[model samples]
Target chain A: MDLATVTARLLKLATKVSDEVGSIISNPELDARMDRVPANLGPYGVDPFGFDPEYLKKCMGMVSWIYHNYFRCQVFGVANVPEGRCLLVGNHSGQLPFDAAMVSTAVFLEREPPRFVRSMIERFVPDTPFISTFMARCGQILGTPENCRRVLSNGDAILVFPEGVGGLNKTWRDRYRLQEFGQGFMRLAIETASPIVPVAVIGAEEQAPTFINAKFIGKLFGVPAFPITPTNPLLPVVGLLPYPTRYRIYFGKPLQFTGDANDEDEVILKKVDEVKATMQAMIDDGLAAREHVFW
Target chain B: MRILITGIAGRLGRRVANRLRRNHEVIGIDRRPCPALPTDIVHHRVDIRRRPAEDVFRHAKIDAVIHLGIIHNFRIPAEQLHARNVMGTETLLKYVSKYNVKKLVLLSSGDVYGASAENSQFIDEDVPLMASQRFPEIRALVAVDRMVQSFFWRHHDIETVILRPTFIVGPNVRNAPSKYFRLRVIPTLMGFDPMVQLLHEDDLLRMLDASLKPGLRGVFNLAGTAPVPLSRILKILGKPTIPVPAPIARALLERAWKYRLTSFPAPELDHIRYNTVLDTSRAKEVLGIEPERSLYEILEPFRAEDQADYTD
Candidate 1:
C-alpha cells in the first residue's frame, strides 16, 4: 500500500486511542454512573429526548453556581408556577440566555420535587455544533409550536421567549424596551389550556450592553447577530464575562386565555399584547426595586 | 397446534422453535441444514422461493406460520436479497393464505421506521415508513411489511401479526449493531447523537409467544428498553467512539462496505445521526407482556463479552 493509505490507517487507529483516553479522563464519573444507576432505564420511566438524570444533576450543579454567585439571581413569585403544564413567558435578553438558565435553575434547585423547565430554543440552535444533542439531552426542544404543544401535552412546564431573536439581540439603547412578542406562545397557551406565567428578568439588561449588531457577522458565521459589547471589542478574551449584575427574576401569577389556535392574527395578538404588557409592568417594578446593577 | 417456523436454524428462529416446542408441535424450515434442533422438532432444508412451500404445508395441517427467513446481512448483493426477501416472502405468504393457516407472524426490524430529524419524540404506529427513502436495500423488508399489513386487512380469517423490533442484542443474536459494538473501536458520524433502544432475547421470544395467544392481532412495535444516546452506549461499554466527519465517513464506509470489511454500511451512518424511538405501549398494554429488563439491564448482560475483548 502507498504511504498515504498507510498514514490514513495509522491515523484512524490513533484516533481510537485518543478517544478512549480522552473520554475516560474528561468524564471521570462515567464509570460511576454505570455503577450507581440501574442500567439503561427502569420499569416506571424514560424521558423521550434521551434525558439523563445523572447528566442533568451535573449541569444543575454548575448552573446553581452561576445563579447564586455570578448573577446573584433572586426569584420571586415562583409559587405562581402551576403544578402541571404551563407556559413561562419571559423577556429574552443579555445576548447569552443567562435569563433562561437562571429561571430553570431556580425551578430545578429551589422548588420542591425540583422541576426541569423545558426551554424552547431558537430554530438555529440545533444546527450548531455539539450544542444540538447537548440541548436535546438537557430536555431543550426546538422553538416550534408543534414541539411546544407536545411538551405541554406531556404536562411539562415550558419556557417561551416570544420576542424570539428580536429580544435577545437588542442593542444597549433598546435594553429595557420590550419587542413585539411572537404570537405563537399565546396560541399555544390557548390550544393546550396551559396557563401563562409572565416573567420579568431585571438587571440582565446591563449584563452585556451590546452597541453593535453586525448583520455582516451574522451572515458570515450563521448566528442570530454579531453583537459587540464594550468589553467584547476592547478585551477579546475577558469580553465574554457579563458584568456580575444582581439579577431579580419575578414570576407573575398565571394568566389563562380561552381561544382557538386557529384564531385570527388580530385575536392572537391581543392575548400576546396582554402578556407583553404584564411582563413590561413587572420589568418596571423590578427596575424600581433593584438596589444596584452589581452589589 | 402444529406450527412452522422459517429460518429456524437462525439464532432467533431456533430460540422461537425451542420455546414453542415446549407446548406445541414445530416444523422448522431453512435453506441451510440445521443440526442443532431437537429431534422432536422436524426440520426442512429448502429455499421457499425455489421450492414449493406447499410440500411442507401439505405434510401436516399448519395452524400458525412464523416467517423469519428475511436475510439481514448487509454484505449480500441487492438483487439476491430482493429475490430472497421479497420473492421468498411472496411465495410464503401465498402458501400461508392457501394452506388455511390461522395466523402468520412476520419478524421485522425497527429500522423500517427510518431515522430522521423530522420524527416526533416517541414515534407510534401511525408514522409513515421512511426507512426505504434513505436505504433502498431496506425496501425489500418494507415491501414485506406492507404485504403483511395488506394481507391482514384483505383477509379477516387469517390473523397477521406484524412486529417491527429495534436493534436486538444478546449472547446468541447477531446483527449489524451487535457486530459493530463487539469491536474494540466503533465509528460514528460526527455531530449526531441519535437515541436508540435495545430488545433482549427473552423479550423477543416472549413477544413471539404472545403473538400465538388468542385475540392478539395488528401491527406492534416490540421494544422494551428506554432509549439512550449513541455516545452513552459506547461509554457504558468502555468502547471508543471515533466520530468521523459525515462526508469523509460516508465515503470511507462505502469503500469499506464494498470490500466486505465493515459490519455497517454507509447508509447506516444516518442512523447514528438521527433516531427512531418506537413507542411500545401497545405491545405492553395489549399483549400483556412487558420487557423484564430495562435497556440498561439488557446492555449489562453483554458487558462480559465486551470486557473480554478489551482485556485481550
Candidate 2:
C-alpha cells in the first residue's frame, strides 16, 4: 500500500481509539454540561481560534475522570462567574498548570449553563510539540492582549493567571503567598468592560511540593525553571507526576472597574492590586477552611 | 476607464484581467507573454523596471494601475529579486504620480504580519509588518508594502488601496498553499496546527474589482472564511499528512531547499507553527468586500479523488 493509505488507516485507528476512550470517560451528565456552553463553530465544527467542541468533548472523558476521581475536586461559588464576558483571574501554581485545568473543569461541571473558560497559556507553549495544537483544540489560546480582547468582546469567559511563571515555579516555602501580578489583564478588563472573577485554587500549591527552582539548570534547557520536587530527579519521568491532592476551587464574586485602558502603569497596577488582594483573601480563607491537602 | 495591470500573465492577474475586461479597457504588462489573450485586451511584454513599462504609461492615459508584478521566486538570488521588486514598485509609483493616475491598487499578502506566538487572533492593518525579521526572503514584499503605505498618505488626490489578502487557493493558482496541498503526502510540524485563513482566487478577483471603485482607498485585510486549524483543512482535502517534529522538519526542509529539492523556505515553516489570522473588519465596513466562497468550495479543487489508486 502507498504511504497515504497506510497513514489514513493509522489515523482512522487512532480516532477509533480516542472515540472508544472518550465513550468510557464521558457520561451523560458531563455531555449535558458541555452542551450548556454555547459553541460558536464554523461550517467544519471549529471556532475561529481552532477550538473544536467535538474534539474537546472526546478528550474530556479522561480529564473529567481526573477531576472527579484523581483530584476529588470541591468547587464553590461557581455561579459568581457571570453569564456574559468576564475574566477569571486566578493564582498560577502547580508547575504543570494542573491548577488551570482543574479550575476550568470545575466551572465546566458545576455551573448551570456551563461556561467554557478559555485560559491564556504561556508564550513558549505555542512553540512546544503536541501540547500547542492540543491546547488550542481544547479552547486555550496564547496569552496576548489582543487575544484576550477578542474573546472578551465575543462574550466568552477567560481564565488568566496574572502571576504567570512567578507563582508557578515557587518553592514550597513560598506556597500560599501571592506573587506580583502582571497589569495587562487589568487593562484588558478596563478596555473591554468585562468583570473580573478572582479564582483561588487551594490544593495545587501542595501537589508538587517543589523544594527548589533550579534556574541555572532551566537556562541550560531553555525553559522558565527546572522545578526540583521530592519525587522528581530520582524517579525521572514517573516522579514528575503530581501527588493527587484534593483540589478546592473558589470562584469569587465578579469585580468591575472602569477607566482608560491606556492609563499609566501605576494607575493600572492599583486596579490590578484590587483583584490580587481579593484573590489572596480568598486563598487564605480556602486554606483555613480546608481539612487536609491529601483528603 | 483604462486600467493597467502588471504581472498579467500570472494566474490571479489573468483572472483579474478577465473579470475587469468586461466593463473597463484592460492593458497588461509582464515579462512573460500571456498565450491566449483576448483580442480586445492590450498586452505588453516588458519588465516593470524597464523603459518600455514607463513608455506604455507615457503614451496611454491610464486611469488606474494594479501593481501585482512583485516577484516571490526564492530560487532567484536575493539581491536581484529585491532590486526587481523594490525598484519596480518605485518606478511604477513614480510613473503613476507623474502621469496623473488617479487610482492605484497593490496586492499585498497577509504574511507581512508574521506568524508568532505573541500574535493576536485577528491581526488588523495597524500591526507592524514584521515578516522580514524571521523570513529575510520576504524583505522585498514588506519593503514594497511600506513604500505603498507612504505613497497612500503622501498623495491625497490619488486613491491608493492596499489589499493584503490571506493565502489565495484556487484551481489555477500555484501559490505556496496550492503547491503544498498538491503534495501526495504533506509534511507538517508535529505539534503545530496554527489557524490559517484562505482566500479563493475568485473572491480575490471580486475584491480587486471592488477596490477599483471611485473613492475607496485604504489598507484592507481581505480574509476568506473564518480561520480554521491546518489539520482540519488537510482533513477536508482528504490529504494524508506526515507529522514531523518541528526541529527535524526545519532541518530537513532547509537542507532540501539548499539543494533545490523543495520550494518551501525553512523560515516559512513559522506560518504552519503559529497563528497569523487577519482581521478584515475594515474591508467589510469601508470597502464592503466580503469573501463569496465557502470553505468547502475553496478546498474542492485540492480534494483527493475517491477512486484514486492507493496501491500504486
Candidate 3:
C-alpha cells in the first residue's frame, strides 16, 4: 500500500475508535440524570470550587462503565437525601476509594433529580500530581471544615467518610466492623442545619482483603497505611486493583439534630455515635441480604 | 474637598490623583518624582516618615487622605520594607488624626488572606491574616493591614475605610499579577489550577472614590467580576503556559530571584497553587460598586499582540 493509503486507513481507524468510545460514554439516561441536577455555575462555567460539569461528564465515562458493568452498584434510599445541603456520612473501605466513587455515582445516576455529591478528600490528596487537579475539576475538595461549611451553605451534597483512614485501612479481621467516628461531621451538620444521610457501602471490605497493616512502613513512605493483601505483595501493579465485589450502597434517612455546634466533645460524640449506629445497622442489613460477594 | 494621596507616584495613585483632580483639590506626597504628574495638582517629593511629609498636611487643609503608598515589592530588604511601610503608615495615621481628616481610605490587598489549601473559596474580611505564615516576605503588608484595622476602631471620629482588593491589573499597573501575566510563556505549577481574582485599576479607583463617602466606614473586600482558574486567566490572555512540577519550579524561581534574573519570588508560587478568592458582596452592597470591566477587558492589555515591551 502507498503511504497516503496507509495514512487514510490509520485516520479512518482513529475516527472509528473515537466514535465507538463516544457512543459507549454517552447515555441518554445519564444526560437526563445530569439535566435533573441543579448546577450553580459561574459565568466561566465552573462553580466557586472550580468544579466544571462538562469536565466531569467527559471523565465519568470510565467510572460510569464500572458502575454499571464491573461492580454493578445497587443503590437504595437515595430519596432520603433532602432537597438542599446535607452531609453523606458513609463507611470508608475497599482499600482504594472506589467505595466513595460508587456512592457518589449512585446518587448522581440513580437518584431522582440526580444529585451532585462533592466528596471531601484527604488533605494530602491535593498534594498529589494529576489526581489533585482531576479531583477538583470533578467536584472533590480538600477535607477542611471551612470548605465543608462553604459547600454545605451553597446547598450541595458533600460525602464525608468520618471514619477516615481507620475504616479504609482496616485489616480483614475488622471487615464489616465500624471504626470510631469523628465528631467534626456532627458539629458541621448542626452548625449548617443540614441533615445527615448515613451511608452504608457493602462488599467493599472484601475487594482488597488486607491481611496485615504495617504502620511504620506507611510512615516511612509518607502514606496513610501500608496494607499487605495477597495480591498486593505478589502482583505489585495489578494488585492495586480491587476485586469485582458487587457494591450495595444504602443511604439512610436524613438525621436532624439541633444543638450548639460549639458544644463539648462528649456531647458531639453522642451525635456522632448516633450516625455511626445508623450506618452500622444499615451495613449489617446490607450484608445479611447479600448472597455472594462477587455476584 | 481637599484630598491628600500618599504614594501618588505609583500607577494606582497616579490614576486616582488624576481622577480626583477634576473636582477636588488634590495633594500628592511621594519620595519618587512623577515626571508626568499633572501641573495643576500639588506634589510633595518627600518620604512619609520624614519631617517634610507632615508639612504637606500641615501646610494645607487636608479633608481626606487616600493612603495607597504601600511597598509590595518582595525584592526589597526586610527591615527597609518594614520601616518604610509600617513606619510610614504610622506617620500618615498620626497626621490624618492630628489634622482631623474626616475620611481615610487605605488601599490594602486581598493577599493578606494568603493562598492555602485550607482557605475557603470566598474568604471574608473576618478571616485572620495568615499570609505571613507561608510567605514571610509579605509580613509587612499584613502588619500594615492589621495596624490600620486597629486604628480604624480607635478613631471613631474618622471615617476609616480599608479596601482589600485582589490583584489589581491594568495597562500601566506593574504589580505582581500584572507582571506575571505579562510573561511571554507563563510557567504554572503542574497539576494545580487555583482560582484567582483580579480587580481592574479603573474599578479600584471607582471603589476608592466611593469609599470617600461620608459614613461608609469598615473593612471591605473588593473582588472583580468573577473568580476563574489561573489556567483560564492565562487562556483568556492567549498566553502559552509551561506547567512545571512544584519542587522544580520553586527551586528554579529561588535561584532566579536570588540572581536578580526573575521578579517573582519562590514563595509567590503559592498564589498559582491554591485559591484565595475574596467575597465582594460587602463592597458591592456598601460602596454600591458594580465592577465595570469583565475578565476579557481586564486581560486585554496583556494580549500577545498588544504588549510590545516584554521586559521584566
Candidate 4:
C-alpha cells in the first residue's frame, strides 16, 4: 500500500483504539460521543464561536478520562435541554469551574443532537494568550450580553453560569448555596427570545473543597481570590487537580420569559430569581440523594 | 481612454497595463527597473518624488489614473514609505484634478480594518481605520486611503473608487501572505489561530478592471470567497509549526525579518494575531463584481507546488 493509504489505515485504527479506550474507561453511553468526533472538520468548522473542533475533541478526550473515570460524572435530565437555541443557566463553583465543563459535556456527549453549548467566559479569558483561542475554538465566548445575544440569535445553545465567579471560590461550609446570580443572563434570554434551562451540577462544590479564602494571596498572585483548598497552597501543582468526587449533572426544563431585555433592573432580577430558585432546588435534591462523595 | 497605470514594474501592474493596452492608450510609469512592455504601451521611468514622474500626465492626455504604486515593503523606513505612497497619490491627484481626469481607481488593502481583538466578525468598509494605530508599517495604507477618501469627497468632478481588498494570493505570488505560506516552519502565536482571507490575484485584477467601468464610486470592502483559520492553511501545506509565545515569537520574527531570512516581518504578524475578515456585500451590491475564486481555490497553487516537492 502507498504511504497515504497506510497512513489512513493507521489513523483509522488509532481512532478505533482511542474510541474503544474512551468507551471502555468511561460510561458505555459515551461510546457514540467518542465515535461521533470527526477525524478532521478543518479548523474553524470545529465551532462557530471560533472553537477548533479537533482541539475541543482532544480536550474532551482528556476531560472524558476525568468525566467518565476520575469523577465518574453522571448526567440526569439531559434530554430536558430542548433542541434549538436556549440558555443553559447553571451553578458555577468547585473553585476551578468544572461545573461548566460537566454541564456542557452532558449536552455535547449525551444529547441526541450533541449540541456544543457555547459557554460564556469572563473578559480576562480572551485576553490570556493561547487560552483565549482555545476558549473561543472550544465554543466559549466572553460573557458579554451582545456576544450571548449573537450566539442565541444564531440558533445555538449557550451555557452561562449566572453566579459568575461568586458561584466559584465560596467557602467550604457555604458550598452548594448558589451565589448571587447575575441578571445579565435573564436579559439575554428575553432579548434573544431564548428559553432558559436551569442546570444544577452536584459534586463540583466538593471537588476542591476549600479550607480558607486567601484574598490577599490571590491579589499577590494577580488573581481574584486564592482559595486554600486541601491540595492547593501545600501541593501547588497537584493541588490544581480536583478531588475524585462523583459528579451528577441535572438539566432542568426550559423556562420562557416575556419581557424586554432592557427591562427595569428589579424586573429582570425577578426572572433571575426564578432561574436561581430552580437551580437551588435541584442542588438541594441532589445533595440530599447522594450516598457518598467519592462513590 | 488614455489610462495612466502607476507601479508598472510590479507584476500585477505590468499585466494590468498590458491588458488595458488592448483597447485604451496606456501610460505605464515606475521607479523600479522593469523588462520590456508587451505592446502598444508607453513606459515612463520616473520616481513619484521627482518632477519627471508627472511628465507622463503632462505629456499624455490621461482620462483615467489607476494608482497602483503604493510602496508595500519591509526594507523602507516608515516615513519614506508614507512619503512615497501618500505623495505619489498627491502627485497623481493634483494632475488628475489639473488634467480633468474623470475617473480615479485607488487600490487599498483591507488591512486598514485591522486585525484587533474587538473587530466585528466581518468588518465592513464603513468601519473606522484602526490599522494605522495597530502597526506602523500598515500606516502607508491608512494614510493613502485617508488621502483618497478626502480627495474623493473634496473633488466633486473626479469619480474615485477605493478598493480595500484582503491579501492577494495566487500562482507565483510573492508578497507577505504568500511568503508566510512558503515558510518551512511557520511560527504562530502559541495559542492563536486567527482567521485569514485570501483574494485571488486574477480576481483582484478583474475587480480593478471592473472599477474602471463607468459610474463606479465610493469605498468598498472586496471580500474573499472563503475564510479559513491560519492553522488550517499551514496544516494543508504540511508545514511544521513552532508555537512560540507572542513576545518571543515577535522577537524571533523581527530578527529573522531583519536578516531577510523570512518574508513575514513583525508588522504583518498582526494579520494572523486576530480575525479580520472584510464584509463584501457592498462590493457585491454596488460594484456588482464578485470574486470568481474563493480563498480555498487561491491556495491551490501552493498545494500543487508542495505536492510536487513531495513527489520530487
lDDT of 4 at A150: 63
Cα lDDT of all candidates, in order?
A: 0.80, 0.89, 0.88, 0.79
TM-score per candidate: 0.77, 0.93, 0.93, 0.77
Candidate 3 collision pairs: none
Where does candidate 3 stray beyond 4 Å?
A: A1-24, B306-312
In candidate 4 chain A, where is summed lDDT lowest over 10 consecutive residues?
A37-46
* DockQ of all models, two decimals each: 0.22, 0.62, 0.54, 0.25
Model 1 over residues B1-312: C-alpha lDDT tens digits?
899999998888888999999999999889988986888999988889766566998879999989998998757888888889989899998898888999999998788888766666677776778888988878888888888888899989988899888888886777877776777677777777877888888999998899888767888898867777777677667766688887898898899988887777788877777766788888888888878876556666545453644321
Number of backbone collisions per candidate, in order?
2, 1, 0, 6
Please provide, for model 3 over B87-158, each residue's C-alpha lDDT reduced to its tens digit, 9 standing for 90 to 100: 999999999999999999999999999888777667988999999999999999999999999999999999
Order the numbered candidates by DockQ, best leading.
2, 3, 4, 1
Recovery fraction of native interface contacts for candidate 1: 0.29
Candidate 4 residue lDDT tens string, B1-312: 889888988978987887788788888888987778875787788887688876777777888999899878857888788788888888888888987899999888888877777765567777899987768677887888999999999998888999998887876567878777766677788778776777888888778888888887888888655566777777667667888888887898789988987667786777777777776778888877777885456666666354543221
Candidate 2: Cα lDDT at B63: 100
> Chain A TM-score per candidate?
0.83, 0.90, 0.90, 0.85
Misplaced by over 4 Å in model 2 are A1-24, B307-312
- Report the Cα lDDT for candidate 2: 0.89
Relative to the true structure, candidate 2 reaches a TM of: 0.93
lDDT of 1: 0.80
lDDT of 1 by residue, A1-295 (tens): 9999999999999998787555534443433432342223333233666665655555654565677778988889888887888998899899888888899877765565566688987666654447767787677877766677878887889898888778988999998889978887888888899999999999888999998888797798676687788887578758867899988989999999997888999989888888888899999998888888896
